[model samples]
Target: MLVLILGGITFSHAQTKSDSLAIRQAALDYIESQHQPDSAQMARCLHPRLVKRTFWKYPRQQREYLRESHADEMVLLAASYNIKGDKFPPNPRKEVILLDVSSNTASVKLYADEWIDYMHLVKLNNEWKIVNVLWQFKDANRHQ
Candidate 1:
């Protein structure tokens, strides 16, 4: 009985760790797709109903502003921008930290080259997909 209980606990812990890794990978894919402009990979990371909100200060503006974007727009912009020229750094500073995961829902923080994104994800159809993102520029002076 002791051995059986110990084995069950270990299996449960392993499953949780696996889920955490998967959630982290999803967040990484989302950031990488934008940096490299891979539309297919971006689509794989995001859900169709994704809602991304960005907060930034405009040039010479005192107050910050908010902008919203959908998954389709993100993919379209990734394909349109920086395709011909090399805009991103050779080794951009990217980081993904898993904040929390509960059953089918998870949250992660991604520090991309220029901004920090707090992402919300959901497990759907046996896959993890980013559903929402709240982002801001790393430097308060820089604006989009």
Candidate 2:
């Protein structure tokens, strides 16, 4: 009986990790998609009402960047990221998912040698979209 109980607990934890991975994967895909030149390419994974709140390395706090419609916001974010895009086009997304997930929300900890990054995601219209990205970017190298 004890063995069975322990197995169940382990299974639950694994399930949580798996779900969190999915949420985090969505966020990563969105970031990579930003590499594309056009906002339309980035729109696939982003929520129409994605609220972009960034954290600067100096003063640690969530600050309002922009909150707008899908098309407008995507353009703004892509431009800010400095994604010159490519002559080709966006291909199938490539990203890694490592995060903690819950029913309505998720927090993804993007691991890197330099600084830490935490992406907060929310379930909107039954789809996972990154609502907030809080990170202390160490260098100019893009986190994606």
Candidate 3:
């Protein structure tokens, strides 16, 4: 009985780790797909109501919302860089440090470049949706 209990616990932990990995990879893929990547591909990975957060020098919190229709934004992004036929990187190395999930809510810590970033996600129906993100990038060059 004890052995069975231990095995069950281990299985649960493994499943959680797998789920976290999937979410982390999906997030990275979504970000890369924004660089002349397909909208359909983005629609598969990103939440319709994703929110990006940043804090200004005055301590004012700024938020950008990704609504259902992001075609205009995608066009602008492409035009700015003049990347008409650039394909996204095939593989992005995504590292997930932590994931805490409860029912429909999940909190995750992920390593991108400078350090780990935190996000709150919610599972809506059959979809894992990112509801809030807390991250700040110094500059685009810093991301490189």
Candidate 4:
């Protein structure tokens, strides 16, 4: 019985690690699909009910504003570059950090060249999808 319990614990740990890796991959796919203008991959990584919000700073006016975007809009934006035949830089500076994970829910932070995004994800039907995002531009003068 003791051996069986130990085996179960080990299996549980392995499952958690596997889930974490899948979550990370989902987050990476979200970012890469957008950067690459790959609509299919973007759709795969994003939930149908995704809501993305961004805080924009108007330095000239010394004010900030909130902007909201839905999943459809995001997919359209991701594909916009493709429509225009625009090319992105070969190597863009980006980072994805897994913040937390609990069962079917997770949070991740993505640092891109111009902005930082906090993404909320959920495991749906055995697939991880980004459900929400809160982002802001990287301000050099801002204090941490």
Candidate 5:
């Protein structure tokens, strides 16, 4: 009985570690895809209905507004945003922090070159997909 219990605990611990790795990978994929300007890679980690939101104020506008970007737009951005390779500083930052993970759901905080994104991911069909992201400019004054 003791051996069986230990084996079960070991299996559970390994499964949790596996989930953590996958969650972290999904977050990395989301950021690196854009850094690499690979639309296909960006598309892979995003759910079809992914919704990315931000709070922003246009120069000509008076009040801050809620801005949203869908998966299609994100994919297009990944394709063109960094094509010139000058969009970001040399040796840009790309950090992924796995905030939490529970069975089929996970949350991540991604620190990218120009912004920070809080992402929510879900496991579907045995794969992790980013479903939502709330982001803001790293330097509040910088808007791209």
Candidate 6:
């Protein structure tokens, strides 16, 4: 019985590690897909119902407004956001920090050159997909 318990623990640890790695990969894919402007790659990691939200203050606007981007819009943006290849720095910031993971859900924080995104992912059909994100520019005055 003790041996069996230990084996179960070992298996659980391995599974957790695997999940963490997959989750990190999904987050990285989201970031790199944008930088690389690979819409297909971006579509692969995002769920069909993905929702990305941000709070933005338009120029000369007194209040902040909520902005949203869906999966289709994101994929389209990815295809053109960096078409010229000069949008980001030579070595732009792309940091993915795994916040938490469970059996089928995970949360991550991705730091990019211009903004930071808090992302939520879900495991579906044995694949991790980004389902939600809340992002903001690092510098409040900078507008996207």
- Alpha-carbon TM-score of each model against the true structure: 0.80, 0.51, 0.53, 0.76, 0.84, 0.86
- Model 4 local distance difference test score: 0.79
Instruction: Decide which is better by TM-score, 2 or 6.
Output: 6
Question: Tens-digit lDDT track for model 3 on 21-78?
Answer: 5566656544555554455555555565666554434224333343232434433343
Q: Candidate 6: where are CA atoms >4 Å away?
A: 1-15
Report residue 11 deviation for candidate 6 (angstroms).
15
Candidate 1 worst ten-residue window by lDDT: 7-16
Give the runs in model 1 whose Cα sits over 4 Å from its true position.
Answer: 1-15, 57-63
The worst-scoring run of ten residues by lDDT in candidate 3 lies at 58-67
Instruction: Write candidate 1's Cα lDDT for 37-67 as tens digits.
Output: 7888888889999999987666666677888
- lDDT leader: 6
Per-residue lDDT of model 2, residues 48-144, tens digit only: 5665544333223433343223435765666555454442234533334555566777777664334445667777676777666555545733322
- Candidate 5 lDDT over 28-55, as tens digits, reads 8888777779999998899999999988
Q: Order of candidates by lDDT, top first?
A: 6, 5, 1, 4, 2, 3
Ranking by TM-score: 6, 5, 1, 4, 3, 2
Cα RMSD (angstroms) for every candidate in the order listed: 5.3, 7.2, 7.4, 5.6, 5.3, 4.9
Q: Write the per-residue lDDT of candidate 6 for residues 17-75, one digit (tens) a residue.
A: 77888898888889888788999989999999999999877666567788999999999
Error of 2 at 65 (Å): 12
**Candidate 2 residue-wise lDDT at 135:** 56
lDDT of 6: 0.88
Off by over 4 Å in 4: 1-15, 57-63, 82-88, 140-144
Residue-wise C-alpha lDDT for candidate 4, range 55-111, written one tens digit per residue: 666778877777789988877877775454444456776788888777788889998
Misplaced by over 4 Å in model 2 are 1-21, 55-71, 79-97, 111-116, 139-144
lDDT for model 1, please.
Answer: 0.82
Give Cα-based local distance difference scores for all models: 0.82, 0.55, 0.54, 0.79, 0.86, 0.88
The stretch of ten residues in a row with the least summed lDDT in candidate 4 is 6-15
